[model samples]
Structures are given as structure tokens and as C-alpha cells.
Target chain A: MKKIESLSEYRALLGENKKTHNGIDKNCFLLPSGMEKFISAGKVYYRSYDQGILIFIDENSYYNLYYYIEKGSCFPVFSCEKPVLIEELSQNGSRDAYIAANEARLKAAGFGFYRKSFQYEIGIGAEEPQRFCTAEDEQAVKASGFRYDTACYADFRPQIISLWKESLDFGDISGDDLALELSQDEELLTVISGDGAVACTYLYEIVGRDVSEGRHVVTNPSYYRKGLGSFVLGLTLDHLRAEGIKRHYTWIHEQNIPSVRMHERLGFLQNGRSSIQYILK
Target chain B: MEEMMQILKGVRPDVDFENEKLLIDNKVLDSFDIITIVSEFNENFDIEIDVEDLEPYNFNTIEAMWELITKLQEEG
Candidate 1:
């Protein structure tokens, strides 16, 4: 029901509402609280309770929420770029009823529609400072095999995590935790070899089509001189480009020199695109 | 072991896969390595790996990685 327009406004709304939600902890919640940088040119909007039953609405992009329904104690609706194709949960019975009513309201108001991807895109290759292209280092770098394999979120950790624990950087990330984060859709990758793997880059979250972001790129001190960091990103970039994606992004701390340089090498030269997650006890 | 060594050396001439598990630890491979490897895997093996498949497990140790390559090849 609430339509927040500007980033500042969204922040204010988020601060006010995040406290009201349940199931969040005070510590270890690393994600955006309220963000609205639409990948499509149309304005992006998000409105959700503190518990994160948030709905991202963009005039440009689109989603089909009704298609994937997982029933539990209650299935919170996820992904409905348009209300017409969606149905929200309801307190009276199910979230679907609420979504249905909301859909009717939107239809009556003549506001149900699809906009486009955000005007600002995280390109892969660009001569510009912060711009990017679909693929980085194409035809330039040969596959020497020291190639790392990267995946996302915590739920998707494999045996290699425990096998190669001594070489982790990114400030003491354990294999178990990393695996769980991978399940959360966080971007995770590894540069691998026979006796070693060097850098590992991962993001806490990646959403929608406009942009996908990685959290950090952790390099092994032993492999500092080589361009392993660039290699991981180049691989990710090529995969993304192959999928017809237009933009990609990853969050690097302001002071992480190596990471910033690596992202710069990959062409994600923006100053910042971060969302602080709020946890409730 | 030989195939894994070949992949590792292909990625970097100075790689030491003997006691070093690449994905489990950041030793010889890094971002640059991942890109090159992904390209090679995609081209040499003729398989399209989705962005979602990029992870440590996919290219962790030589044995684990060989499993991925073998599986992908089989799937194809």
C-alpha cells in the first residue's frame, strides 16, 4: 500500500518497518534493507514488512509469482513485477487472498504494468571508469586451467570447501558458513588448481535481471602477483554474457585495494551500491 | 592426478596442487584463474555452464573438479 520513491524515502520507510518484522537476528544479517535502483529505465520500488516479505516493483522489469508457489505454514508471495499476475497472502486465510485483493485494487487503479530494466546498468566491458561490458577479457586471456569455479549462496557448498580450508581469505570465512551463504544466492567462486586454489569472490546476494552483485573477492596471499582475481571475474562475466545478461555488479569495501582493482579490471567501477540489513531479535 | 595436474598447470605454470587444494584454499587460482578455466571448460568440453554453477565445489580439488568435468561431459 505504501509507494516509496526516492532512496532516502525508502531508507526512512525501511528504518521504521524493519523493527516490526520477525525472524531476523541483530547480528550477521548482511543484505540491503531497502534498495530501488531499477535495472530497467522505469523507476524501481519496494515495499515490505521488516520480516522481508518485501515485493520489488519496477515499471520496466517483470516476474511471474503465481507460477511458483511453495506451500508451507503460509507461503509468502515472492516476485510479481505486475500485480495482475500475482496474489498476496492474507491473514483471513492465505497470502493468496491478500494478493488477489491487491491485484484487484491495482487493476482498478490502472497502474498494473511493466516498465523496463534500470537505466543504470553494470556493464562488463567499458573504457569508462564505472561502466561494464557483457564479457571481460574475451579473446585476450587463454584458459590456463588454474581456473576457479564459483557458485552462489550457502545452501550450495560442496566437498571442496572442507578440503581446502587453509587458503580462505575474506576475513576468516568457514566452509560451512560459506556454503550456507551460497544457498542464499550469494555469488561464490573459486580459482582452483592441482595443489591449490587462489582467490575466491562471493556476494551475499544477487537479484533480478538488471544487475547481479558479488560481495568480496578473497585472494590467497601466495597467489597475489598473478591475475587470478581478474580470471574469476572474467569467467563469471563470460558466463553471464553468454546468458544474455546486460549488467552485473559486486560490492567491494571502500578500502579493499586488491578487490577494487580486480573489479576495476572487470569494469565494475562504481563508487557504491550497498544495502544494510536490519536484524530483529 | 595427471589430468588434474594438467589442468592446474594449464591455469598457472607455478601451481602446486600436491598439498594445495585450490578451492578449499586460495593458493594458486583466483578470479583470473576462474575466468580462464570457465572459458576452457566451456570451449574444450563443449558445455555451457550457468553463472549459478560457479562455486568452490565445482573446482575445488583435482578429484572434485574432475568429477564436475566428467559429470558435465556425461550430461552432454
Candidate 2:
């Protein structure tokens, strides 16, 4: 195995391996551009193997590598600067087989299962219901002076980062990483803010042909149960629809019942895809 | 080509893969269907269909998919 040092080399290796394997891992296949950013930031380290490659994000970074070591890939044998989390996505029915095949090697490497999430998707059809905030909720938001709008990262970087850290447990994402993400598109982050406080936020990205993934949605605990979560998510769905996105995808932790219910209430359905994150810390 | 059509139809029985020229752009087939089709093509034709070959233009119609398969086979 050789460490990939340049983006061009990474791309070439990826192409060659795709031909050899008949297909590349979906995460790696879709993440070249993001990899470029992370590489430039000096936050990504990856090594190429015959079956596939293994990517590692810096221990202090928030950029999660949703990568899988192919079924027959060389076992990862590298050391990390800090505790590393390896997240793997597998088809629901194959989850057990996936674990059975890799768990031992992972355990030998001091990694253990961290968390699991269920993947859900909703297709935008002509007759699909348009669910947004109810009239009472809208009135309440207006009365409280809270308004939904696209946030300028430069203006709300501190609050955004603070709220992100406060509300989510994905780990510490560097501000630079957040900046890189927001720089991808001006309208990627939407927020409901009032009186200098960002109450709710939604971040999404176009992941594939006509498909958008809702990457993150968070509401301040102080603003919980005020319908801010639903309001922002509803508007995001509308926004994606207007941008010609036909399918929307999101992942919710298996233990996050409230979030799962919220997504289901808005028409998202489990699509038999789930992922487990393993960490060696 | 007929075998390819059968594979495509087997994966998505309701779609008219032969006539429809926008299987991907029109969102008629999702990612799962594409994965199944790629696996079938690779196994049946003994051709390696790389991720780069998963563009919409190569899968929007039955003819396009057949062209991709033939090209890959010739290369192989």
C-alpha cells in the first residue's frame, strides 16, 4: 500500500481501482471534490490498497470519513495521531454479514461500534404533499420575531459553530471545515434566527443526480418544541424541490426517535440502507 | 442487447427502459436500481463497469447502457 499524497494521484488511483473492482465504494466515489478541499486543508490522509483505499481524517477535525474497507481489502494497518472513527454504510439486510466479516479485524485494531443510523429518503412527486409550518406555528414564529432565512457564514460563524457543537454529537468539526463546507455554496446553510441568536439551522448538499442529502439539522435546546426544527426542514425540502432535486436523503441515529418521527412526519421513509460508526479512541 | 434489456427490466419491472431516454435525469431509477444493474452487467458481460461509467448519459436509455457494456467489453 502507498500513501496518496496529491489530488491528481488520488483521482488516478481511484479510477484504476474502480476498473479493477468493477465499482468503487460509493462514499469514495462521491467525495473526490470534498477530498480535494480536505487535502488542501491538510486534514486528510489516505492509503491506496489493491482492493480499495482507506481514508483518515485528522483527529481534531469534524469531517467524518464515511468509508468502508472493501470486503477483501487489506486490513488497515496504520497508526493514527489520535483516536479515529471509522464509519461504514451497508445495506440493511447485509449489516450482520458486514459486521461478522470485519468486526474481528476492527476489534483487533482496538475499534468498537460507536453508533448506527437509519437512512431515509423521500421522492418529490407531482402529487406529494407540501408540508410546512402550520398557521399557528407560523404566527407564533412571527410573533416571536423569528424568521427563516439563508445565513451568511461570515456573519454567523461563531453562533453556527457554537450551536453545532451544542446540539449535535458528531464530534468536534473545525471552524475551517465548516467554512470550507459553507464556501461550497452560498445557500447551503439556512437558519431561523432572531435577536442575534440562531435558533434552528439546516444544512444540505446535492449528493447525486437529482438527489439532495440533508446533512444536518439542529435546533437550540432553548428553542426546542417551538416547531423550529420542522419549520426549517420543511422550507429546506421546498428549497430542494425548487432547485429540481427529485430525491432527498437523510440519516437519523437509531436512538433518536424524535428526529426519526420528525422525518417520517414529513414523508421520509427508511430505504433499507443503514450505517454503523466504529471508533478507536 | 436483449439480455441486457431483460436484466434492466428484471431490476425495474415497471419502467420502459428501452424507450425512456432519461432513466437517471427523470429520476425513474434510483441509486439502488443502478447498483443492481451495474452488478448484473459486470457479472453477465464479464466487463468492469467503473464508477466513472455511471454517468447519466450512459444509463439514460437501454441503448446507452448497451453501448457502455459493449465498449467496456471491447476494452476488456
Candidate 3:
């Protein structure tokens, strides 16, 4: 295992791999102020072994109006579980072998057993237009200063792409050469603030079989305590209710109570989270 | 490493400098510290790095960082 002491040193080595080979993503950024607090008071380190990367973020301000940012592919599955470092699993390690290693790490680290958690994936927009919202109301809401800026998919392509890197859990974000996305098939709307607070959403037409899903409703850190989550959800529901789109799905990390509460406040009920598995080695 | 020296000087002039690695070791640069550095690097180098590059490796040490910055410059 290599101990990474400096950002530059870590980068030089990782440049030989995906951590560097992959370009930057905008939505993945943390507010500079929040980062300052973390740096001055917190310690974050990443270890690169022959197997894979292990990131440790310490001194995190947990349960204090939290937000879910970057996560690995298994995040949705792992939920509250951090991978236990055992003898690095071989690239060819069996699934059972990896699971065994995790069990060993948990036992060794004394990491308590984790209870399975559930998250929701609501089905939205499968039905025809029902409730409709006028541009005037949308503008008035923005003019009132509660909503920062209201831009629909048509109005928000560059806007969405501008924050696109936030979508890292789903794909390879490289050479896309664009910020914001305008969808012929999907609709997205969001509001951004000068302080880097973001709570916007994407509305998909259908889900799992024909089920529709609401991609996300995120409230940035700067505006965490400001009820921005409710505001975004209010707008989304208004829009969905108008178009008669219902049964939408969104993911909330099981541990983020505030966000889950916000969603529940907006009438999003819970569904189960399918387990996500990974082999880092 | 020179890129790092120049970056550090531009961001923090209050302190005398030595090994670029000392900045991280001495607690002068942390995560947020790293963000500011990346932001500044973007402005000065005309290269863009966002969330995907937030690894400790990218800006952990001056000499170590040159590899990524140089690569970005080339890609640019």
C-alpha cells in the first residue's frame, strides 16, 4: 500500500490510472467554503494498493443537514457500508471470496453489522397531461427570490450540462465537450445560486418496465438549511401534477435523513434499494 | 514542480516556500485548499478540472501534480 501525503503526489501516480485519466466533472465539486472547513478541521486520505483505491474522509460534519455527493458504483448498494480493507481481493476473486473478505474486515475492524435499508424509485410521467403550470407562475416564483432561476429542459441544456459531472455514478464523463443537456426524451429543471447551492431535478418518462423516475432533487450545501429542498420538490410536483406525470422515482442515500424527510414531505414514498456489489481488486 | 511553485506563490504569498510537499505536510493545503488551487490552476492555465479530479493524487504534491497538469496542458 502507498501512503499518499500530498495532492500532487497522489495525482502523479493516479495519472497512470483512471483517477487521473478521467477528466474533471463540474457537479462533483464541493463548495470552497465547505472544503475550507474540512481542510482546516478534517483529514481526507486515499490509499492506492495493487487492488484499488480506498478513500477515507474523516471529520465529516455528519447528521448536520447532510448531502450526498460523490459515490462509487456500489454506493447505491453499499448504502451505509464502507468496504472493509482485507487482503486485496484478486481481480479474479470470486464474488463469494469478496464477500468473505468484507466479512473478515468487518470483524477485524469491529464494524457493526449493517441492517438493510430501503430507498424509493417513484414512477413518474407515464400518464397524459393533467395539471398544467403557466410560464407566468414559474417566472413569478423566480421573481419572488424563493426560486433562483427556473429553466425547463429547453432552457436548461447548458445549465444541466454545466452541472453534468454530478452524474459520475452512471457513466464515463469524458470528451463530452458540453455542459447541460437538452433532452428530446427527458425533461429537466433546476435552480442554481451564486453561493453554489443546487436543487434541481430531471423527469424521466418511465421507469423499470414502464415505470417513470424522477432523476434527482439535490439541494447544495450553501443552501442546506434554507428549505431549498422543499422548494425544488414543490416546483417538481407542480410541474408533474400539471403534466399529469406521477409515480416518479428518485434515490436518497438511506443515511441522509433530512433529504429523505424532504422527499417524504413531497409525497415520495419509499421503495427498496437493490443491493450493489463491487470487486475493487 | 515549477507549476506548483508558481501556483503556490500566486495563492499564498504570506509564507516563505521550500519543498512543495511541505505545504501539504505542514497543513497549509487541505481539501478546500486543494479546490482553491485547482480553481486557480484553471484560471491561469486555461485548463478545466472538476469533481472527477478531486483525488489527493491530483494535487497532493508539487512534483507528483506536474504529471496531471502537464497532461491536461497537452490535451488542451
Candidate 4:
């Protein structure tokens, strides 16, 4: 449990993956604030293994561990040799084999039972013109003092990723180019504060007619209770409904209570589908 | 029309609903706000509104909202 203080050392540990988990790149363990907190009070731990380096940040209350494997799909489904918490935050159609490999470590780390959870696929039917926003919503947005914008995600990828990581269960974010490609979709919506996006939502995969798969409903942590979610999503879904988008569906993690509540309040009924999350007790 | 304004104020008290004509285009009222308002309208007028009718023109002004309600009522 030694501090890997140098940036070069941290990069070498991650093997230059250029990917991020919880706003942490290969270069640093914590963000600027988290780093400062850890430097002052918390302790960063490091251990080298055959497959990769295990970097752990002990922030007193909870510990965050990462195993930067050198090769193979670092996606949880492929490799879980030194597995971390396999929750909704990073489920990517993984097979049982990877979970099987981490059994020893899972037990060693005192991980609890294998519980099943899922990201829901719920739809908004075009039968009712989805007027999901109200004048109160407009007042709420005005009160929050954030402006709504569309198709501007490329400019705020980092902020977007940070917000999502802070709120929703998310894994490795797409690179800048991929982020730009996604934002270019004419239907994407964003709410901006200061210089960057505070929240965003968009649809993908034109299934049939005008129906699409929606995802990435994220709000900045600082702006959570300010009704920004209602404001931005209200604008986006209305526009989507108006676009003759007969139906809009999104995947929500069952454990994400706030998200489920918001979706339900916005008139999305849950479809009967789920996935399993394996744990070792 | 005044009734609709009351409903609008109930959901969002701060907005000057009388002056704001471009509710949708100007980003005054969001989709949730529209949904809240529409749901209120459906309950009050006893009319079913479809997604196709949820256009900006239908919600931009109090008069537009009244016209939409009246039109939907007439259709019924």
C-alpha cells in the first residue's frame, strides 16, 4: 500500500490505456479535488502483478481498486482476473467465464452474494402526444439559470463523462472523435451552464419507423435538485415527440432509483426485461 | 384562455405566460412542462390529445392552448 506519486509511474501502471473510469485517466488516480483530498488525508496504494498493476485509493470510507491489464479486452466481460465491483456501472454483455476467473479474488475481497440487476428498456408510445414539460418546468429551468442547447456534446465530453460517472453507473467513455460523432446526431439535446454541458440525453439506432433507442440521461451532480433533469429532458422528449418519433426507449439500471422515478414520472412504463449481476459472497 | 394561464402558472409560477409567445421555439416551456400542461388540459377538458398534436404552435401561447383544446373538443 504505497503511494505511486509520479504521473509517469501511474501511466506505466495503466499501460497507457487512454481510457477513463470514474473521471480517472491513466495518468492520475483521483481528479484534482479527490487528489488533493487523498494527498492531504487519504492514501494511494499500488501493487504489481503478472497481468497488470493493481492501484487502490483508500479514501478512509471506501476503497476504489483498479486492475490495468496489459492485453485482452479490458471490458469486464472479457477479463476479470482482479475483478472490482461488477455493478450496473460497467456491465457490457460479459460472459460467465470472466466472472468465473475472479472467484478467488472476489472471495478474498469479501464481496457479497451474486445479485441480478438490469438496465430497463422502457418506451414512450406516440399514441399520446408526449407533452412531458410544463410551464412550471419552464419556471424551474429559469430559476436554475441554465440555458438549453442542442447538438453541442462534442464541446463538453469531459464534463459530460464526469457528470455521468458521478450520477449514473457508466464505464469507459468514448473518445473525443466518437463523442463528436454521437453529438452530430440531429436529435441530441443538452443543457449548458457556464462553458460546458450540465446535462444531456440522446437517442440512437433507428429501429423502425421513427422509433429510436435513447440513452445517456445525465445531470451534473452540482445541479441535481435544481429541476435541470426535468427541464432538459422535457425539451428533448417534446422535440423528439414532435419529430414524429413514434416511440423512444431507454435502458435504466434497476438500482438507479432516481432515474427510474424520473422516467416513470415522465410517463415511461417499464418493459419486462432484465440482466444478472454476479457477485461472490 | 385565463383558465389555461392559471394552469401554466400553477406548474411554473415565475414565468410571465401572457407575454411569452414563443414557448417552444424560444425554449420557454420544456417537454416536461408541456406534458404537465397537456395532462392538466386532458383532465380538465376531458379530451384525448395525441403526440402528433403536440406541436409548438399548439402550446406557444395561451390562445394557442385554448384553440387546441377547443379544436380537440370540437373533434370529439
Candidates in order have lDDT scores of 0.43, 0.70, 0.45, 0.54
Task: Give the CAPRI rating of model 1.
Answer: incorrect
> What is the C-alpha lDDT profile of model 1 across A170-256, one tens digit per residue?
322245555555444334454433244333443323343323555445555565666656665666666555555545655444455
Candidate 3: tens digits of C-alpha lDDT, residues A88-203: 11111212343454454334434434432344533345453332334665565466454454464454455455454554332212214223223433445555443333445433
Candidate 1 lDDT, B1-73, residue by residue in tens: 4655665676555455565575534424544345456555655666644333455666667777677777877
Residue B9 lDDT (model 4): 85
DockQ of each: 0.01, 0.23, 0.03, 0.01
Candidate topping lDDT: 2
TM-score of each: 0.35, 0.73, 0.35, 0.41
lDDT of 4 by residue, A75-95 (tens): 222233332343322223222
User: For candidate 2 chain A, which ten residues in a row score worst on lDDT?
Assistant: A22-31
lDDT of 2 at A169: 71
Name the DockQ score for candidate 2.
0.23
Ranking by lDDT: 2, 4, 3, 1
Stretches of candidate 1 exceeding 4 Å from the true structure: A1-121, A125-145, A148-175, A183-191, A194-206, A271-281, B1-76
TM-score of 3: 0.35
Score candidate 4 by TM-score against the native: 0.41
Give me the runs in candidate 4 sitting further than 4 Å from their true place. Answer: A1-126, A165-168, A171-187, A192-207, A277-281, B1-76
Better of 2 and 4 by TM-score: 2
Interface RMSD, in order shown: 17.1, 5.1, 17.4, 19.7
Stretches of model 3 off by over 4 angstroms after superposition: A1-117, A121-143, A146-159, A162-184, A190-205, A208-210, A279-281, B1-76
